[model samples]
Target: MMTIMRKSPINVRAAAKEASHERIVQAAARAIRRSGYDGTGVADIMKDAGLTHGAFYAHFESREAMLAEAVDRAGAESNGFGARVIAAVPAEQAFQALIQAYLSKEHLAGIETGCPVAALGSEMPRQAPEVRRAATRRIKEMIDLVARQSPDWGQPGVHERALVTVATMVGTLMLARAVDDAALSDSLCSAALKRLAPSDA
Candidate 1:
């Protein structure tokens, strides 16, 4: 027989449902970053995803489930950005590139699409355990990425340096976004870059 069989209705329905689920998660990721965890609502996320509020439960068991998935997506996006920044440079410059990108003006102004750690760190503890765990996992991944980039990687103090580097970058970005003064925001980013990057940077 030369003819091919079409996908079964059950498989098609499953695929469609999976696509809707992804749309909901992506929308929630941006929503959570734009509006902190406490501010993001299931209805808003569903609307943003072009779905009805009633469809949310079909994809997630609860609001916390959706938020946890959103956190993971947001963290993945940030990690991907950092990875791209590091990939653009030589191994020796990876750490500097990461620091520069994290504290860049573009990042400072792009809060909704930027690092979840900086945008949501303060609110993490107040979130449900699943959400907190999701954030913690990503934060640890970030720290580990920085550690691998450190010149002292595999040495005794590299992990500590990575911890400080991640903390400073997240803190600087948070403050830069928190301040109302544009001058102070720019200064915060610049000062962080100067202090955290290699002396040559």
Candidate 2:
């Protein structure tokens, strides 16, 4: 005879609670990127997650705890994008594709969903230790991803080269978005492509 396994009431409630926690973290991730760290509030995050403010304490110990989780989620989303770009092309062309994708018009306009470091780097130092720690860990992973893409992957200077590349891309995009002139914005990105990716970049 075949037997069916049923979840206990405790397990069902635990799953529901876990789902709510995930919803809050996802919403907070987007909120921080969209509105900056200082601008995102617990009430706003909870509301965006379709939960009440009173329920927030059930999911997190403090505002900083939620923000820390948000940082991780945001970093993961951005890193996932980079990973996909590298995977979508041939090994020899992967690095160029990542550079091109990072500076593309699509990414340029996608502040809330793009790289967390580029979006929140300036504000990172002021965050709680846990939040900053989370961001720092993700940033290291991002740099590693870039470095591993280098043709000289395990070479002596590849890590430094990856550092410069990431810095240049982030700075260029930040400047491009800072300017109000559409021409300058396009020019900034074009100039970066000229040096970073060139052809398809």
**Highest TM-score against the true fold, candidate:** 1
lDDT tens string, model 1, 1-201?
699989999999999999999999999999999999989988899998999999887888999999999999999999989999999999999988899889988998898899999999999879999999998999999999999988789999899999999999999999999999999999989988898995585
Give me the overall lDDT of model 1.
Answer: 0.92
lDDT of each: 0.92, 0.90
Residue 56 shift from truth in candidate 1, angstroms: 0.8
CA deviation > 4 Å runs, candidate 1:
199-201
Q: Global lDDT for candidate 2?
A: 0.90
Residue-wise C-alpha lDDT for candidate 2, range 88-129, written one tens digit per residue: 999988888888898889998998888878788889989999
Clashing residue pairs in all predictions, respectively, total 0, 0
State candidate 1's TM-score. 0.97
Best by lDDT: 1
Looking at candidate 2, the ten consecutive residues that score lowest on lDDT are 192-201
